[model samples]
Target: MAKLENLVQLLDRSLSLHGPRPLFGTKADGRWSWITYAEFGQLVARFRGGLASLGVQRGDRVALISNNRVEWAVAAYACFSMGVAVVPMYEAQLPAEWAFIINDCEASVAIVATPQIYEKCRDLPEKAPSLKHIVCLFEPEGPDGAPGARTTSYGALLAAGEKGPAPAIDPTAADTACLIYTSGTTGNPKGVILSHGNIASNVCAVLDLIPFGSADRSLSFLPWTHSFGHTGELHVMITVGASMALSESVDKIVANLAEVHPTVLMSVPRIFCRIYEGVQKQMTEKPALVQGLFRAGLRAAARQNKGEALGLVERLTLAAADRVIFSKIRDKFGGKLKYAISGGAALSYEVAEFVDALGITVYEGYGLTETSPVVAVNYPGARRLGTVGKPIPGVRVEIDRSETHDSRQGEIVVYGPNVMVGYHKRDEENKAVMMEDGGFRTGDLGYLDEDGYLHVTGRIKEQYKLENGKYVAPSPIEDKLKLSPLINNAMVYGDNRLFNVALIVPEMTALSEWARGEGLTFDSPGAMLRHPRVIARVQAEVDRCSSDAKGFEKIKKVALTDEDFTAENGMLTPTLKLKRRVVLAKYAPVLDALYSGSTKAAPREAAPPG
Candidate 1:
């Protein structure tokens, strides 16, 4: 394929080459539907014309709030072809966040998914004065549940465009294509300004490595609002003329997987973790002989993956297990999954190995939103167990040892065309992450191994994304907990895991007074902390403090300790700041137990503290 100057060019090329090929697959009324590339191209052109009728022009911004749908794709491409930037927000995000993003980006139009969402955002214009139009993908219902009001439906937009087609303006490589908002440590989300060239270069570089083509199909559930899903899955698939089946919802992914028989799956670590857990759960129900065979096969596969010589007996056992056990697991995935691309957060090595042993290659990659979300990835020919593979073409990576105490690893600095122009309008934040030589400081601490594969160690920034790829900034939540007299100190812990848990230290004096008021008795501090009543009380405080937090940011579980982090304990720095690594290391077991359904601070017996 010719070098993609912009995303519009990519769309046009695919239309010319694969006009009759299926481009999008959508599910509705318990049935699957497909739209061809030519049909998609025509829709984009009409949508662009409709947007123009509303006075949307080059350099203007359109805010989109929806889950993955055919209309969402149409709106995005339409905006991109007109040199308009699309600001996409997650449907799962709070309505307040949507308003903030709309105002921040000064969006001229806001396109939402459903009538319910429109109801939530109807008052947004009062808050976001820049927003002039609110277009709903579905028509809004009146008091009797029929089509109502002036809210423009997606179909209406297409009709308007068809009546008076707007010419597609080929955007330059440097024009901003989208603003992807990601959470920061202390404040509201910051918009990462990615240009057309930034994402196009990433897609082209990834296409050169991965073996996706027109025949490949993907069941896409990952939100395109995320850079990984947008550029990596949506854009990359379009470039190669691959079809994508939009998953109905997260709960229906498995059913859709079987129905679509997709050749590719682009997802975060959480999805793979669920698949591994499901397989393990099924194995527990199998006969002893089958379970033994499965375990032996998995062990042999692991050894082989490590390049260890396999005995003839082990090889035979693996082949038998593949036919009897693994094949069924693959069948649940429709037996057509060529490979899965795991990104957004670090995937567990065990999960990757489990999927690989089942004949599905899981190509793990690492990147941040600031770098168009793809720095390095393991592909077909080159893969390592723990490391994200070598940097893609046109990307340069260097380690800044001065940022870390460990000589072998440091902050990863990247320079590439894929790098974003900068965070929108945040010059100070830009200066902090941009290097003197134009390299972007990745904030992640990692190292390149002897073979040039990158091994991610840890993060320098306290902000982290959970296994589900939702970013959480612990300090703000921790600070809120400490505000309660019941909580003397708190540290939220959930990085690359399903949900958030916290380790909290109680105010001993206040706790004792409360215990006395409740007529509770206990011998030691640990015993007092472990009392069910005390645990419930502290949990109440946590609930009260985090009531306003986003759903993902709220603490799901808690572990209590009488031990306070102090300078002497090395959990606190000389400046009285919490040393997160030290705190996590000391309380790792207790915190981990919370996720395993063992509420460590809740006692088995009815013991009271006084």
Candidate 2:
């Protein structure tokens, strides 16, 4: 494999090597549809010409508002080939966020997924002066030929491009390729200016290590607006000539998985967590003998994972469990999922083990959008259960211990070609993160072990100190808590407080089912959560999950809520990371009451572990 100079070269190489191979798949009329690499190349050419027809020239930015779709790829590749920077915004994002990104990037054209989105964004130009044209992926209600008041259908642009095709122009590696806005867990999202070299280098490095070939397929649901999905999945898959079946929606992932039978799975931890919970829930409904056998099989798997010997009985039990229980579970994932790449957040160790035990190799990686999203990842032949794998080729990982208590742990600083140029137009902010030596200070706190695997501890901004001055990294704790089926989402807070506390959102469906089985009656989800028996049960779950945690890391008290931290709720990023500040502010009274011991916040203080 030749080294990629830019994304254009990457695309061209794949097209040349595997032109007739399938590149993308879409579901329509209850079946999966595919587009070959050569056909994808043609779409890129037409999209490039279409962008050109809209007066979108090289160096200009184009805002894309859509989910994972073939057209999204078309527009992105077209921009990359034309030396145009793509500013991708999530469909789940608020209109104001779209306008802000568009204005920030000075996007000349905006391409949306549907007419409904078009209507919402048609008036964006009123606020975003640089946004001169808006194109809809679906045809709008109008005439077929000409543009409509600065808005037009995707069909029109493709037709115009076909009439006057624009030849592919490979941009220099140093040129800007995309402007990915951070999920903005705190303040306004900063646009990370990633160059062609930045993303291309990441894709190349990843492809070199990961053995993804033309035969592999992925059920794509992670938003392309995210760097994890954009560079990790989209560009990497295209470069390797692998096919991606775009999931209809998050709700349709399982259905699409069975239909697509993807060999490779790339997703966030939440999805994996749900799968773990689902499997656990299902097992509870099984016969006692079956449940006992499953538990024994899990013990055998754990022993195997640790290179420990298993007894003949355990081995037989594990084989039977695999054949009876695990095989059925694996079949749900199309029975062909060989590798699952977990990024965007730390995957729970339990979930990772569960999936691996079921036969799918789960590789957990760690990176931020600023590093073109992949600094280190676990692959075959080099994998650790708890730690993210070694840094990719050409990437250097260093830990700055200036602020951390531990000798070997601190901020994870990354120096690599994959590092972004800078945050777009935020020089002061850039200076804060970008080192004079070219390394980007990933605010994430972690340490590279002697084995060279990176263990991400927590976000520096999210980690808080207790009254005793013990630093608590809430992410690991929160991740463990959510592993319990009773807890949907959790945020740990105890900055300058006596001990850590949590705001937990009960997994409503699971909670409701549990309540029904326990013969507990409640008028609402809130009432059920407020029940003493329910609180005691949930606390036990929390305790069980955090059994191995350090003294300061355990949740001393918790306040239950039905409100899930979601993108729409303004308490979570589009990538599903908790907005600590937002969540803390919203639940301040409840959290404060936990310390006071006299408030009506329904904060049940758990007895300290003996």
Top candidate on lDDT is 2
Q: Which ten residues in a row have the lowest lDDT in candidate 1?
A: 601-610
**TM-score of candidate 2 to 2 decimals:** 0.96
lDDT against the true structure, each candidate? 0.84, 0.86
Alpha-carbon shift of residue 397 in model 2 (angstroms): 0.4
Model 1 CA lDDT for position 452? 89
TM-score of each: 0.79, 0.96
Model 1 over residues 1-610: C-alpha lDDT tens digits? 4578799999999999999999999888889999999999999999999999898999999999998888999999999999999999877666787889998899989998987788888878878888878788986565422122136778888999999999999899999999999843335779999999999899899888988999999999988988889999999999999999999888989989999999999997668867876788678789999999999999988888767999999999989999999888888898899888988766766678888888888799999889998999998788997678889988999999894556798889999998889998899999999888889998887899988898876566886889998767676577567656577788999999999999888878878888989999888777888878888888888999899989999898888887777745556632234778777766777788888898757221321221
Error of 1 at 423 (Å): 0.8
Residue 200, candidate 2: how far off, in angstroms? 1.0
> What TM-score number comes out for model 1?
0.79
